[model samples]
Target: MMFRKIALTLLTATLGTSGAYAKKAPKFEQAHQLTSEQAALVQKSIGQEKILIKAIQQRTPLVETYIQDTRPDVKLYQIPVGDQYTLSRVDFGKGFFDKTYETKDSANKKGWFKGSLASITGITKALGLDKHFTYNPTGFMQMMFLDPTGFDQQHYVFSYVRREFLGSVRTWVFDVHPKVAGMGRFYGRIWIEDQDGNVVRFNGTYTGPKSEDDSRYYFHFDSWRMNVQPGIWLPVAIYVEESTRDGEKQVGLKAQTHFWGYSLKLPTRDSESVSMKVDDAEDKSEDSTDVSPLQASREWVLQAENNVIDRLEQAGLVAPLTPNGFETTVLDQIVTNLVVPNNIALSLPVHCRIMLTDTVEVTTVGNTILISKGLIDTMPRNEATIASVISMELAHIALGHHIDTRYAFNDRLMFPDESSFRRINMNHNDHDNQEAAAKAQQYLDASMYKDQLSTAGLYWSQLASRGGVLKALNTPKLGDSLLKTDGTPWMATIAHSAPKLNWDDLAQIPALPLGSWLKTDPWDDHVHQLNAKLYAPLNPRDKMPLEVTPVYFRLQRYDEAQSQAANAAAAKPNPGAAAPANPPAAGDPPAQPTGQPTGGTQPPAGTDQPVPSQAEGPQPQQTGGTPNPQQ
Candidate 1:
């Protein structure tokens, strides 16, 4: 797993080192020039960049950045040594400014981002990555824009590469570099969609002024944007990586930054007001019986749950509830599979929601369970593993560990979105978690997943082994950490029985890498299972559980009409196609087998298998969750 040490100078240079610059001499004979049509597209892209900048200024979005510093490891190849995390709601109205959301120490600070000129300086000071030599945090953010002030033919030279397809959008590829040696200039390649001439993706590093080594101050990054609205593209994600000499040692870092909550500023009425008193409205229940004492107590707790969930959603911390969504389709089935077999009866049905962060944590805000996206992404695509995690929160519900009743008062949740982590507390106490853990075991043993406990146990073992290095990732912002205070995972009982860790065992996939299963929609903040070809691991090194990997998006445009048309076309049968065996007649219902309802619901992929392979290989589809409607 040792990375070949590369020269910092060559790693941070412009395309000149690759002969692209050498080919473009004074005579321009070996230069690659853009055709008239391509030149027009480039001009349109320049204007679109300006439009994107202006549009972004009108909205404030949440920006989350996570960094993992790695040194070479003999066994695991490269293991993280240190990590950093920062979450903020950035206001780009007049300049780059942010209100910290994940930390209370700097929650009230107003100077995270000052302006364009000193933006890098503000970010470096805020991130505190280095005190001796500053590494620009804004360098990653600036990847969203080619150049804020100047991004045209006057300042940059564009050479045509070719036409390419990024997901469903066809793009014109071009390599660009600054015309003169200048400070903070973008030198990289861009992918511009052919339809609107908007830059869909850009990858490279920023160049420093003459005589300065850019590698010390800048990092290589790949930034991607999504068509959030018609003719409006916004930055969605950025992946940054750097390997350079820190003193005599070869040190490297990998980081990712995600942006969402674009429509946070849009005006909408409060959801709580929808049930306000209406004229001549009467009770709808036929019995007209008074609510019992038990029902009243439960309703009181439900009030607190509803308040917190609503507030989190409004603050862009939780995804909007969508029917047949990931939670409803995949997670809900897992809950049912556990509850029905255990014969657990509840006064109200349990539900789940995803917290839109890359923290490995889970908690119950009353009966509703909240699991972070990072936890879901890292878990092996096995039903028992996911069920094991969910069963703990389900135990909390059964044990009646309710959220604090104070939150039922609407005024308690009136604080700003930036203070969400500070104001709200949903994590369970140690005693309660211990009790729930024991109860969770009881539920798992009585359920259909009893036989697969060994596989689920391996996940806990893998998590416990990496707990020391991945502290920041495992630390929860709004919920409970899976590990106890002494570093043992809460489900230590399961890990104790798991098969011993064997690095050479390629088939033993303890956990999957981060971003393996779920992807978030930038515009709507919806989480969906990735419809990707799951490949079996070629070696044990391929199973990089809970590690930060490079980000590659299958970029596509947002077109509602085109999407519907495609869906309809897919549903239409071929005229010459042969009929299925015993096709149902017209106007008659399709026959469904007894004991299993047709299309009623299907479990998340791999419910029947006790041990599912979690690897990346080129073959038939592997086990995971159901495909999203937008697929």
Candidate 2:
């Protein structure tokens, strides 16, 4: 679910009082029309929604999110692990339903929030007044408007939007508003597939009650949906972009949420290997030693690389599960673009892997390039920035400054990541590093990315403004710096087209935080696409690039999962209940269900103390977007 707290004083803005310099001055006109068929379809869904919602409340879909809060004061700084944004994150499961909130903010007295324009009180409570931000019982499903009560005529006014094809499905879209402006009412647009009339997507915010002090207002949002089953339209993602005024200043912030693994309980994957007997085995491809000794040795190295990859996957540190499924495809597109233009080819295909960590680094193991999820998240949002990183590695490959065959021993697969770093050496001597950098420069000049290096230069200029903090990102995970040598920047022509970097300039966004553009699964760790919507926060202070948010899952798993959680909570005292207890066996205390607190009079368990689990904390990221460079 998306939460928009930036204040837009529609009451004043509508009165034509704040138009002089208001960024989002004109505002989206609340105008719409619906055909009779569309109205009937919507009514039908509203009546039957409760039943579908009940079923949804039973299953759990994996939830993934990333939030980035950027402002002038939120500069890159050395924070414990490394230089990072004034950022916060949330990564958890159960669609983020029935989840607790956490933050990286340590010093907590009367902290002023940077993004509160609509609801200053709400932000004040979260940052200064409340012990911690908590999810309301209504839960994230509220974001989808599946609750029948929400759509009743007494509360909402609906208007027909248009008939548009979202993908192959033609849909009837509508604008929604609350009869009265209050937190309980939803405001936005909804898309319904013409055939079923099920709400395919809803984009907007709920009406919040007027503040007595007149200090808060609701922020705008865009929610979306996807068909998971034949007749089931599931809410897949929510994007929130809020712009609010803080006194005379305006602020902006961006946030994204994702939901997947809906049919996860049912077997979604099948074995691709064919069943075979001993006879089939005897006719297998070939023996490893069949090739010439030199060729066989190279084959051994390849097999070893595969082994290392498999080990990383099992450890939850590789692509798809790590930086997410997009890494492989992204690497492929880059390689395709570079290889075809530069006429570079290899005997075996090159692969890319991502490590899911906050460390900014990159390295190559055999033909595969390993990039940290953090680096991908922090880099300037441009294809050229990515190409620059890849070119350096490709240069190393071309110059043959590579990992020795020492790791060809499959036994090395058992080594841990830290230990393997010492054994699977991919670093080059300083002299070789310089040669690779020079060669990488030449290769880029001869490739398609060369013309775009001016933008790539802008990236380097920004990175350099971090005053050496970005140098770590330039440093290879296992080798010498790709963009820096010694203490000075090495990409001399990297910023050929961009303006100078200015860290203190609120008008300029120098760099994004880790995971600003990518999201990771809290379950199987698969990464997926966040809705690529844009929100230009009119006020720079409201530009929160990466911030912590309350977890609001699309559904709370109250069916069997609720029973399981209850059984687990009930059995907590007796640590030995083998069978799952239902409805509290005999004399035992009643189990606190998923949404409600066990001890009613008291607040939820983590109200006072922050959640300690990083994986359990609230997460958010900036949406990945950049103008596509012309080839």
Candidate 3:
């Protein structure tokens, strides 16, 4: 689906003479033999992978990929120098078939691609050339599955490493490599759940022919799936990273691809229709006063707002209205905090909703203010920075900057989801932005956040400084970007009084990495605050502002109701049945007590230790990571 125009010479320039830095592929001659019990589980997992593939094909899901091209930095290990982003609903049902041509003979150069490399290369060639080769953003999607065709022992060797726990699930970890080198196979480690034999997570890159430049075709990726249903595990996210050295200079890229909206369907009028009980249904128009001309105009504008919001929700771009959701509980409170203090009265109540994109943008849809998830994710986890962003859109609402009334007509939204950005126009022009920025300053001056404006300015300063490199992250799809096209931030005046940018100041955290504040439910698309612990940064590099990092979930099972129901069903005694005295056979996975992580709350076996970040990586922190204060 990506129409990237890559130059033919880019492969050599970016990767540097392919064979110059290529690492030798691993040999599997000394593979460990699995016991009967371990072999049975391995067999079960292979079958489960096939089932997972079939389940994915039956549903269309939203796929979002964000890439950060990084370069060496003295303070922060690596900072984003450039970026790319793509969001679309991919139909796995149609299937993506890409191949790798790894043979030495030019005529017979062909092998199935392990990742989406072939598709990316094909698209780049078809679209002609550009100065920098832009990869098909969806190329990383192929990392979700091991091998769609030959994933069995006939093609791969699985050596049991140890038993481990990823979140609450118990899994058997194994080292996997392809039996033959030229077939384009997955070379990685996989974690299979002990209970159902599902491959919950896999990490590594694809392998091609020995002589071919594998580095050009593949990058390391860690793909993880969530148990959405009782026995169904769907691919939720994949993190890709590659770091290589060319003498003293280091070059690499980091990307995160997320999938959601699996249950999305075509919009229908009937879906919006509400049926009420006859006794409870009543019209209050009879007791209300007739509408004044002013009221009538407001009503028309409100209609346009509702129509646009409803259409966006149906398209899965906007999260559904949940009563206790982030918008109602967190965002709405922030609006009230600003509105009441400034006495900004309007015809309708100003509310907020989250746009499910990671792009940093904000715009007003009539009285409703929409903020992108990326904007929220990268901000300092404090009220002032968040309030500063919200205040800008609130000013737009108060100033009567609204969406086009043409959207009031339901027929206007009949286009496909892919055409959403093209069809919907909600961005504010320069005049409106200038006026809103001035008005937003006034609102902040009168609000509780006035004193904290200095800290808020720091966040803006960081954003403005990095705006030049992080163009894709700053660009808006449906709203105005925080930064001007020329790399100057709209709120530059607000940040004019802030202190100079200092990397060594451990206490001064301008921003956090993406996904620092919110976590989206893959099934429902609802946004929630991450239940993370807070810790002070140990060094300046710990504050990875606006950079892409690896994804790690606390990893809880989905649908607790289903798990509870199954437990209840199992707890009931069979009629006239007695408990069996016989012990379980050898190699049987030991049963652990309920309500605890699998394997009795003990750490996983082997050298793999629990990561504090998402309980798997280095020390986890709510704000930007700082090194230990004691260090």
Candidate 4:
């Protein structure tokens, strides 16, 4: 056993060294020593003409057959315009798959068209096209040559790779790649017949970005085409298997072997035979053309300005008077401060009009910015909230957010349409960072607009109290549709039961600039019923306290004169009235009641007697008191 192990070790070491030595050896020497026939074969393989001819003879006719045998989820059609044809189809596999087809015609006319399954299905049902379901042979043949771009080159690149025998048919296999980004679905390999270059069988896999339906790949197409007519390739059947990484799969199969009986062709004339030679004539005619660079530059500038205005109008940022003045000012400041100084050429102005809405939304049309009303409404009644909104949008603009060169026209500048937009969700990145927060702090520290910041916070707090609908709309969560989703806050969740202070109590409190007038009232007509139900009862006792109205404070006052008669009446004494008798002193003992009167006046015993006054000056009345002397 030990001897065997040593022998095996030696063998392995020998093999490893030999493999390493071979890899280090020069590869160019072996290539240079190739036989003449082998070199000729290599040259023949890469030649463009041979490849083109093989592709045309093998793949061109199979195109129509492939369409005929396309999965039921995909519909193909031809649109004719002025003797030219445009082919387009809608893939119904995922949520409304949109695709356009373009082709070049023999008459040098370019044809391009788009149609969705919704449109085609309506047409088919309306015209009863489904009743005549038989395959149209002539239509299938014509579809192959309808190139929308007026060019004969195929949209897919094909390279002959190998030859293999499959189920009694010798096949020529080729590798195919899409030449354009939005071309039809791409697969890895295609197999054709070795005898006449007709595609016999094909097997390949397709991969692309994950779709909305969780599709990780576009479609995996495995199909077989046969030569039904001599040297004419046709698709016998096709199969497609779709899947995602999560083990979801949808398999489909389609077959189209028979052809329509009818065929039509346009009348032909022998124009080549009737052509005659004409004498060549040359005339010397020259005209001078003048071009002005200044005029061109002015025109270009005007066009750019017009485009900006149009975009602003569409985004609802520009009005007859406003004309996005705020946005323009912000952009100018940014350009002057950051972009121009840094030598960075801005494709779009660094300005955005952010709509204050419940949810956060940031989008741009040309140089105009559109923010949600909800975002603005939810902000604290202070400048910081405003700064927050502006800074968020400004970050987008400053970072060159809406700049795109993929689409030729500016009309297609949509952030959601961008490839990168799909990669990121609500997460904030370097582009939209904390610049707004920082700027707000800076302004607050500077004390330049302290009141505005406080007001902004109040505003935001009020908005937040109303709920985060504005924030939600502006920063929409997944599945929130613009047209259908109800992003409003629920009444049950809001803290609507505010403290009920009487009007008198409210009035008595020291007044601030805030709540001088009723800011919000439960009984207000504008208040929603749901909101009103949630509000606490308004107290009638709450009164608006009396403050010095400027007008009232400026009024004059007057005093009445004193009267002499009133003073005399007040000084006169009451002569007819008698004073109340005083109580007996505490120290004096009870005095014995005298039966007989003493000294000044006397009365008979046992008789209730009255005292008589002396002198005729004043007379006493029997009623109980003496009459006035004047009477």
lDDT for position 360 in model 1: 89
Candidate 4 residue lDDT tens string, 214-240: 122223445444333334343333343
TM-score each candidate: 0.80, 0.48, 0.79, 0.23
**Alpha carbon lDDT at 513, candidate 1:** 80
Q: Report the error of model 1 at residue 4, Å.
A: 16
lDDT of each: 0.70, 0.47, 0.70, 0.28
Cα deviation in Å at residue 443, candidate 4? 5.5
Off by over 4 Å in 3: 1-26, 97-133, 211-213, 246-248, 266-279, 417-421, 559-631
Task: Please give the lDDT score at residue 623 for candidate 1.
Answer: 19
Q: Rank the candidates by lDDT, best first.
A: 1, 3, 2, 4
What is candidate 3's TM-score against the reference?
0.79
lDDT of 3 by residue, 516-540 (tens): 8777767777776565776778888
Residue 520's lDDT within candidate 1 is: 76
Write model 1 residue lDDT over 1-631, tens digit each, in one string: 1223333333232464555432322311233778999999999999998899889988767677787888876777787787766655556775743321111112222322444333223322332322433233444565566687778999888999999999878999998888776666678889999988999999987665542225544567899998877778899999988776666777888989998888876323344355556799887789666877776777788788888887778767788754445675567557766665665655565677899888889999876889998899888878788889999998998798878988888767763522333567799999999999999999889877889899899999999898888877887778899999778999888888899988888778888887887787776787766758877777666777788889987776678534953584466432222122232211122233233311112222211222111121111111135322122
Model 1 — which ten-residue stretch has the worst lDDT? Answer: 611-620
- Candidate 2 lDDT at 418 equals 31
Candidate 4: regions farther than 4 A off: 1-369, 377-384, 395-431, 443-447, 461-474, 477-631
